[model samples]
Target: MLSIEPLNQADIPVTASLHRDNLRLGLFPKLGRHFLGLYQQSFASSPYGIALVARDEGTVVGALFGTTSNAEHYRWVTRNFGSKLALAGCSAMLTRPQVALDFACTRAGRYAKGIARHVGLTPSGSSGPKAASRPVSVLSHIVTDVNARRRGVGRRLIQGFASHATLLGIHRALLVTEEGGLGTPFFERLGCRLVGQHKSQDGATLREYRLIFDEEGAYEDRDGGRVAYTVVRAYPKRLGPASTRPQRP
Candidate 1:
């Protein structure tokens, strides 16, 4: 039987190793470790972090991690893990210069604008547009052991995260994945709607999927347990095409 629960400190290393081995990003030996360090700081040890792990007979089989507030969580990660990230950045620049350049270029616009806002050149609310005020949560990472696939592990892990967010009074959750990658279809099958699309630093197309919680409708007396939720489908004004929109139960 597969069971989901809060990720323990002892399991973090295994989770990081899975991330590196399963989702290679063309980094060197030590760089991968540093990358995992960033994930660890953001999702495992950070006070604002929320993470879940799936186990089968005491063996770790899958994991998911995210934050309730992107803005606050990012600030905390940068402040606490800044040095480690800097070292990793420097190493990547020296070793994989092109990759580093591409990443920097891709994120430059957003960071530059953010910096400008911080310096009072552009006030936070001065912008004419802003994301919806709904408390948006992020599922930054989700990985399942290869042997554990096709056994509802991924779905249950996601369900566990959703339950956590729901209990915390968050009503929306989102995640970014490569558009044509394996995760896209999986998320779609799990009832997450594609809300946005963009290109990644490596030029790969990325799609954003959102799962909205129906607080009242998600519960009921069903088989002596709560009702399984079916999220509502809604298109964000910023995104195009409703063809790939998610379905409501």
Candidate 2:
């Protein structure tokens, strides 16, 4: 039987390995060790973080990191992930300078924009959902084990995460993926609609998809079964009061 559970500390190494082995995002495989851990920790340590893992016969087959508020999430990440990234970057520089340099250069623009948003130079809605101030949920670093791809692993993982968001009163869950990538169709099939498109710093096009739970109370797949997964939320200890967004199942 497959089960969804809150990600625990012991699961990190295996889940990180899964991300390295399966996810094909640019620079992910190159700095998989450091970057995956950083992303997971950024979410895990945040007050708004919602981390989950899917287990089959005691092994992790899929995992995801989510947050109810990007603004608060980014603030925590900026304050906490900086030193760790610098240290990791320094280590990569010594062994693989070219790869390290390329990764750093590519991320320069994103870091600048993040800073602009934090400092208020990039106004809300300037970059659409990326800068939206309204209550929003971010789905980040979602991946399924290559060996377990088509057995409903990804769907269960997403449904589990979305259920958690619904419990927290967040209606909009969004993620960005490379255009024409496997994730595009996967997310679309789960009822996430394409909302916008933008170019990455390296000029690759990316599409943003949003699953509005309010509009999609429960989705009917082509087979006519309602998508469903059960998630048990640990008591939420948010950094602030919960969002005022209307709750919907």
Candidate 3:
């Protein structure tokens, strides 16, 4: 049967490969291996992030990657980076409106951060508009292999995280996905409702969604066992057991 678990040292290559291949299929950075490696390093090492993968027997076939973030966790990116983006856009307009067009997408990407960061512009002693705050659980990202689509692999991987979050007693689980893409409908059907919509730093529009979870849910793999994949990640020794072989076809 297919099983899901957190990604660790052994699964790096699998996560990296799936991430790279997905990028090639139109995800992000769209860069070659060099940049992909850089991304892998960050993703693998980030304590705030987690990657869950699905295996059929011993073969790695699907994955779901996510980052853990609190409400204030967006400070660095939104305030500083996004403010720079807004400034750059304004400067572009003052000099060349055409150049400003280039930053239109950039500003939109930073809009959420712009909103978040501006709360700090006022002096600390002065009563200013408070930064937005609310109860939040760990944030995450998710992906599945294209070849393995529609057989419930994505569901398996995502549900794995849901179970993990529930066990951790995290009441809310949040994630972002392209609003109109394959993931949109998928998440919606799974009971995650849209919470917000925004543009990306690269001008792509995205939707944020969340779900209230109970730890009692069970995650089952529909793949029935090992799923085939062009690439695979290694198992985290700290996790329970290594994937096992499926019955012969």
Candidate 4:
């Protein structure tokens, strides 16, 4: 049986490993599995974060990490895991000069600005009056094991995420992916609207997608199936054996 539920502490290692192995487009995976583990931990521990996993029997096959408030979540992560993440990142840069070069070329300035804003060294830009009417959650990361593809794991995980967000009174969610990337069509099929396009610091074309929850209390999939928004609670018992190996999807 396949089940979708909130991520738990024990699932961190598998989730991190899956992230490191499967999601290779960004800089985080190059930082190594330990760094990814702490990254996932930050999400699991943050009040504004949402972490969900899809499990078959007892092994995790897919995972999703998001935040209700990007700004607040960044601050929470910086306050709690900044030092550890910096150390891990430094270690990665030392061992892999290419990763160092990539960071310097791409993320250094953005990260610096984020840190400055987190510590109040930089002023947050004006929110304007319309900011109150816009409550957009972020869908940070989502991935599924290769072996689990075509089995509805990704769809269920997304649906479960939407359901959880709705329970939190969040009706809008946003995500960004590389333009024309493998996941782009998948997201489109799920009814995400293309809101904008921009270039990343690394020069990759990035596409922004927004998903709006309907007032009728259900989200319609591409197949015309209407899935009601309802949270899938975690199982009371711990997971079983951990021998299952994951393949990239």
Task: For model 1, state the Cα shift of residue 146 in Å.
Answer: 1.1
Off by over 4 Å in 3: 23-28, 37-44, 71-135, 215-249
Extract clashing residue pairs from model 4.
Answer: 146-247, 146-248, 146-249
Q: Is candidate 1 or 3 superior in TM-score?
A: 1
lDDT of 3 by residue, 16-59 (tens): 67766764322232333333433444444544445677887866
Stretches > 4 Å off in candidate 1 = 24-30, 108-133, 215-249
Q: Rank the candidates by TM-score, best first.
A: 4, 2, 1, 3
Model 3 clashing-pair count: 13
Q: In order, how many clashes per candidate?
A: 0, 0, 13, 3
Per-residue lDDT of 214 in model 2? 46
Q: After superposition, how far is residue 229 of candidate 4 from its true place, in Å?
A: 21
Q: Which predicted model would earn the best lDDT?
A: 4
Candidate 3: lDDT of 243? Answer: 31
TM-score for each of the candidates:
0.73, 0.76, 0.57, 0.83
Better of 1 and 3 by lDDT: 1
Error at 139, model 2, angstroms: 1.0
Candidates' C-alpha lDDT: 0.67, 0.70, 0.53, 0.78
In candidate 2, the residue pairs with backbone N, CA or C atoms under 3 Å apart (3 or more residues apart, or in different chains) clash, namely none
